[model samples]
Target chain A: MTGLPEPLRSRLHPLDRTLDTLETPAVLIDADVADANLVRWQQRCDRAGVANRPHIKTHRSVAWALRQLELGAEGITVQTVGEAEIMADAGISDIFLTTNVLGEAKLARLGAVASRCSLSVVADSAEIVDAAAAAARAAGATITVLVECDTGGGRCGLADPAAIAALALRIAGSEGAKFGGLMTYPGAGKRLQTEQALQAAIAACRGTGLTVPAVSSGGSPDMWKDDGLEPLTEYRAGTYIYNDRALLSRGTATLDQCAMTVLATVVSRPTAGRAIIDAGSKALTSDLLGLDGYGLVLEHPDAVIYQLNEEHGLLDVSRCSAPPSVGDRVHVLPNHTCVVTNLFDRLFIVSGGRLQGALPVEARGRSI
Target chain B: MTGLPEPLRSRLHPLDRTLDTLETPAVLIDADVADANLVRWQQRCDRAGVANRPHIKTHRSVAWALRQLELGAEGITVQTVGEAEIMADAGISDIFLTTNVLGEAKLARLGAVASRCSLSVVADSAEIVDAAAAAARAAGATITVLVECDTGGGRCGLADPAAIAALALRIAGSEGAKFGGLMTYPGAGKRLQTEQALQAAIAACRGTGLTVPAVSSGGSPDMWKDDGLEPLTEYRAGTYIYNDRALLSRGTATLDQCAMTVLATVVSRPTAGRAIIDAGSKALTSDLLGLDGYGLVLEHPDAVIYQLNEEHGLLDVSRCSAPPSVGDRVHVLPNHTCVVTNLFDRLFIVSGGRLQGALPVEARGRSI
Candidate 1:
């Protein structure tokens, strides 16, 4: 990339600009790498005879979701009603709402989404089942309810298999709800415990005369560990589309497989041992994921991103043999890719090191 | 607030819906409390006889910025050219960009901002000054350059007074650039060191026959500690508009003074000792700021927000005598306020315990 002024340089390269020519603090999604990841994950799911329901929270782009569907994903998993609404409006017919919708205001929106598309939601309690059924009935929609099981995630789900079966029965008995299946966001490195929990929940549901059609369990850390022999019919993995530093550290993916990267410029060389990048917590996000630093500078492997402020990433380049200079552009692989998508409204798409058009993260900040 | 269904409840209150009626994972800014905070801080700055350049990073709203100016703010401090451009387009004439924009593409945008408003930027290196000066000259705009001093803020800025003085001289000698002043984001609890560094830089500038017009220093943690006795012409303070848990922990703000609160609903109660909220790192953000938990639940003070996923906030409520139930609404005072504004596209403006309207965070992700 020529270092000429922006307008002149853009005129010089009319078709596509390189990564360095793009604006700093920009999010780059290597389209080739992302497509390869999509195909690879789809092949694995296809081989296992299990449904691959890709989670849309990673990219949050309707275009990317469509691309995933084009690659043969069964249905997309949305964590919120807002995302479901967006995907449904975009003509995505099938969606699985992973998060439990309880509040009447939010459930009504979910009901509206269900009316627009084939929507299914998760519930861990009878209260949520009743509320969702009421909302669905009011909206004249049929909502499938997946009983969420606590498969060691410990966040939101019933740990007791009896409770899970009871919730499934309640949903089937409800006015506008249908008992669909079981879903569990398994904790990392707890595949055995997760399988046991799911097996117990399935058995309890069968005992209650309820047929659990689909059992879904997924997490990025355990993406490749699932042998499909577990009591699961579908898998939901979000971070596989754009693996991050955490996934790289786990050996789940390599640097070549990381689709998303934060392009930042060295704005300040404060000292010989210290350099400041324009991308900070606002751009890269403050998700450590048990890592020591916010992210890894792909160009300078020895340089450590030791600290981060709202708009400044402080790099401890003391150990680096050749530190970066001001205006030098660098790519950062964030610790968590999901939060990084939430941080930006749009991401710059790149392929073969050439800049492509920017895609808006339509589901960004759509937590509700 | 009423457990009565949504349509009935909304029809009951035709105009004003309470906080309970708002959607979960919503960011509510108490207008009254925010105005009180504005007035109180303005009064303090007024008494000190210093220019109050309130940083717009906290609210990222043009309406709030105009209100601050109406309440006698000298100017608004922006951290990026994108923010400056948004404020300048909104007719805010004076903007001080606290970040160092160095790259050609970004510097050109900063030049455009300079052409539109009274723009000033901080720089700690001659490379930045030279690049900014070239961009300014090319754009036919005059940009003010402030020599950034380390001043105990270990992130950016030069530590050596001689180097700062030399950079200031370069700014003064460069075309389309004027040496404005000395600026530093003083480290928390290092006021003396900051003052000494600033005093030395000031003296060095004087030695070089460069009379610093403005000696600006500011930080939220050190907001009240500045007695205006230190050599300074202006102070930049963000995060004071809506003091957060960090300030609350520092004894700088009380519970009644925090204007911003994340209104989330208890979605699930998987166990007797645990309840999950809809707001997580996405809505509330992951900025711990050395805090123990993600945030403080206002209603349930004993409830600890122990874990945060992208959309789930796990609360350890064993210590609480009265645990929350599903669909129960809760307000979370985040560990940091600045990052919350960046996470949302709009904020709910609440006044008199009623939801007034939603204000767009126009400069939310405007980081170049």
Candidate 2:
């Protein structure tokens, strides 16, 4: 009686109350699993002598961000200026924006947010560094700039060590900008190349009389396989807090360890093999992340969500002898729960099978 | 001159202001194109003598729904109870809920909203019909119930015409429910089967001495090619407002007719053939809808958005003769514009390439 757990005998408990009282298509954050996840990651980083700066995009709740801070996280990492502003408003002092800040409007916003908090951003190009420096000077604030190295990731970053060092030197030379360190997503399965690139970039920066104080590396898929560890001052990961199927499929996190689960009700059983649930692409989201189905049905492991409309999840239950009927509730572990957080307004918090309350997902869809 | 277009020559216009002043990763709705779409669809439905009940889920906007009503839309269609409540709250007199109402909480909500507006719902199961009737009776409201038919759509619906008529007869007999008509999504490329099912259902209902007033059909993919209109009293279409790449790929819509364009900035041109934009799965969404890439970059038709992280859209520009550089903006036609509406809080409205204002996507992510 797990995954889509059977209704508890005790109706007074919060979990049963949630299942019984709340409408379908609700996001439930199991506090026990989430708290354990937070503690486990923080301890791992502490053991490695590295600062754990959790990315807020996964949970996107100020309450969880504060909880991570209480667990002794060094700071917080944000991908957009809107996230930094929101987290800063909630008194999160140290913020690191991982995306390259481009354009005049965004640069001006970056400077404003920097003035409000101890802010640092990544830069892979000299033009970005110059623009940030200019914006910082105009706002009467000094910005800490990190050189983003491509390492093995095919996304944004300078692939060449010399270019990373040169960009670091350029930032260090700017009066309004201070060269902070190096940052990279470090494409998974290319550890040797990722480490080598960072080490070489550090030596190149040192050759130019630029001191590297902090080096950040991240990517949840390869976070736990720390064989020897890279030359990292800190590690940033968002999905560690509420593991999804992407982590589960990789054997990184077990089924019981996943904190967030989507609770949906079977709206129709059109055929013997098909059961349509209230949760759809808008609720669970369509981020497959290289998985087979949309999410994992806890009650029936054989069930596969073959398709989704805007408000319906089509589950092929042909293989399951005991399938969910109309009005039967099923708990689903979303393939990628990060996108799920941004899909809803609030998440139901459950502890000890009792509904504690709900926390608003305030930073959701803050794509500006 | 087109997508990801170069800055407009006239900066004083609202469209130019939106292009130059607004931040990247913004959703822009072209009024001229959108208005043309609305009028064209409305006129088509008028000529067919079918009521044009536009689905609000496409835009998830109250302003747009009101505009549609002003343009002679029979009534607005909603997929979820939350959408119905919101539209009803906006003084919308009539609302049709397409999804089946299951469970006590949602049924109670349905009855409450029915009390507020001329509310109707679709039901394929006897249990849903009974539960909704009981809820309506308790709330002192009569919910107009439409029998949902499968009609080749493998999702939620009663496939057999006799079963559809049985459900309609049951609703007609219920004191708290009224037999409104029949409804089906009518899965694309199955017109003959869809019409046959509807005609049979209507005959079965007539044999049962139940009057069928409305026979509603909807599906945006094959909407334009009406070989011969079905026996429908009303038609529903959502994506026709802001045509997307999915419609464009199928030749249902042309590139020039796409109204909703994601305006994103090129944050990094990491290599000669790769550029990263600020818009990712969160901004543009990952709904391929049988399309090739994430979106169609208007400026570089050959460029492909191969992959997406949370905040980065990776572009493969090796085949493009003139690729966009850093700080350059790109107007992207999303793979599916419906999901994109749910990803933003406010969509910027553009007229004559100028920023008219913004409409709150108030009904977005209302999967309740």
lDDT of 2 by residue, A4-85 (tens): 2111112113333454778889999887798889889999999999999999999887878888888899999999999888
The residue-by-residue lDDT of candidate 2 on B1-368, one tens digit each, is 23311111111122334468788789998877987898899999998888999998999888778878988999989999999988888899999999988877788888899887888888999988998888889889888899999988888899887888889889999999999999999888887888899999999999899889999998787788776467989988999999999998888899888999999988898899999999999998888887778999999999999998888899999999999988888988899999999988788877777677666887887889
For candidate 1, the docking band is medium
Number of backbone clashes in candidate 1: 0
Interface RMSD of each: 1.0, 1.0
Each candidate's fnat, listed in order, reads 0.82, 0.75
DockQ for all models:
0.73, 0.73
TM-score of 2: 0.95
Q: What is the lDDT of residue B88 in candidate 2?
A: 89
lDDT of 1 at B314: 94
